[model samples]
Target: MVIPETFFAERTSLLKASEIRELLKWVAEGGIISFGGGMPSPATFPRQQIIEAITEGISEHGDKLLQYGTTQGLNELRSELKNFMEWRGINVSNVDDIVVLSGSQQGLDMFGKVFIDEGDVVLMELPAYLAAINAFKLYDPEFVGLKMDDDGIIMDSLESVLKELKSKHKKVKFLYTVPTCQNPTGVTLSVERRKRLLELASEYDFLIIEDDPYSLILYEPIDVAPLKSMDGEGRVTYLSTFSKILSPGLRLGWVLADARLIKKFVLAKQGMDLCTSPLLQYIAYVALKRKVIQENLSKIRGLYKTKRDKMLEALETYFPEGCKWTTPIGGLFIFAWVPERVNTKELIQDCIKKYGIAYVPGQSFFVDESGTNTMRLNFSYPAMDEIEEGIKRLGQAIKERL
Candidate 1:
């Protein structure tokens, strides 16, 4: 049978396939200790509570859950998220401003569909989330990278990019960021930077899509509010998820925006799935209603804190002199930089073969430049003992390479 070329959208040709997923497939078959993926430890998930919540939902809601539901998602689920955000000092007056997504990744995809068009400009941190890069790339959006440092993406660099785009008479659809505990870097943007970012967004008249799935897992008390909290004009779209906190299996998350924009997202979501799984939403609602999410988050925060500390400590003790990494206040991963001569892409394979340990090269995270001498080490999944050994293996791999 012959196939038509028009069966696929022309925009799909723009995206390179996901490198992380390819690496993970190889790593999973290697039978080695791994720290590659930024996956939370399933050991920390509230399996029992999830079971209870699902049972309760089935008992209480029955076929209502098994049937089609509103495109805006369950009203009670949206209400629960609104209250949760309110506790964080973020105010969303209309409950309709929120839309339920399968997870924050789906939220990114939906936003890409609604806001991004052919040749539209989308700004992102230099080394940003790969999934966001992949999701947005498929829409043929032009990506501009803002400079980054230990304190997160530099404000001046962001301003320069925005100014340049403005001068060229270009309209940037949105800037994507994981402000707190950013992926691949694990650096939190300071409160001052966060406010400055919002100011720049206002000046440029673009949107900031703040993807913050890890903020709630902070190890220390955070004084900085979300960009959405400071946004009075409804320019920032906030996305959060239950995946990192309660259960990834649930695939439940929420998107907060202006009611008008949310209406667009609702239409986009309707085309994607009509609605998020009713059964999953009902179970999540029950979990929140019963305080199961809170309980699970507490447990996860404590466990990941210890894991993060152990990995940081190992970096200090085991890595060679001049090696550097960020000491994140909270998060599952840390980015390590070796001397410029050392290529982490090659080193990771050596570490896997020689020491039965693995980590992800930072090259895959960047949009323009490939970071060959850097690596991102995930600390959440490995136990304390395993972390020590993994670090030792990684360090040995580096030393041998040198």
Candidate 2:
């Protein structure tokens, strides 16, 4: 018997496999130097501390942890998270304003479910996070791409887009951004631009989704602050994860938003997973209470900074003239633009087969279908030698294509 496509939901047709995950499968088979996934370096994980936390938690509270938790999340973890957010300068007046998630990825899906209506305008960066572009697409919203420079989303372009949309009477549902050390591009929104973005949101009467997974991983001392901290009108919904600071395997994340909005997310989440794992939430609480997560951050920042510098050096020495990439101050990726003639999507399979190197092609990250000559490379996962060797192989592939 054969299964028919019609048997599936109509929305299943909109689903597409993540290109980064597909590349990861090839990397798992060996012999590929990967710059595909935004994976944290294993060295950064506080293994001994995590082991101790798990042992202590299970011994002290095994009976409570093994049972199912509340739909909102474990109360102890939520209280700890409130304090954690405060340390980062985000004020949370009550624990009810936060909801733990399976991962920040779940929060993205929840946003689509709770907020989006078909054909509602959802603004995005020119080349935004691929996973976010895919997540919001399932809701059938109209995605409007905004232009960006090194400093991040250009306010002029945003102002123009808002005015044009107003003329057509199209109100944006929300503007989604990975503002600090943004994925795919690694450019941070400047403080001035961040202020202007908030002003524009207020003027246009729209919400802002600030997906901030990389702010804590900054390699340099910058004066930037989380958008949620600056939000006086409660217009920004902030999402962050333990994936960068701790370990991705635990799969824990949280969202801070208005109490009403969090209530909706909790309702939506009840249907999705009922609640995030109680066992994992306990581990995170222990990590925070012991100050293990904070203690490990400096080491993560130092290690990633060295990798970023090495990759930048390799690009300068090996990549051909006219090829350019961002000098990321932090984060796992360095997005690059090859000569206009080289389509990275067409070149990826060949790169994997012949050159033994892998990077995420940039086209899928663009909601507008525009970044054909670009790619995003991860510096945090591969070894130092692999960073240099992979860049050499990638440069050769582009040269041959040219």
Clash counts per candidate, in order, are 0, 0
Per-residue lDDT value at 67 in model 2: 83
lDDT comparing candidate 1 with the true structure:
0.85
- Highest lDDT: give the candidate number: 2
What does candidate 1's lDDT look like per residue over 1-402, in tens digits? 677878977766776767567667766786777888777888877778778777877888877888888988999988988888898789979889888898888998998898888799999887888899889888888888888998888998888888888899999889999999998788899999998988888888889999988888889887878888989778899999988877777888899988778889988988898988888998778777777877777888899999998898888889997699988877777988998899888787777677888788888788776687888888998778999988987887788877
lDDT of all predictions: 0.85, 0.94
**Worst ten in a row by lDDT for model 2:** 49-58
Per-residue lDDT tens digits for candidate 2, residues 342-383, read 999999988998999999999999999999999999999999
Residue 251 in model 2: lDDT: 96
TM-score of every prediction relative to native: 0.95, 0.99
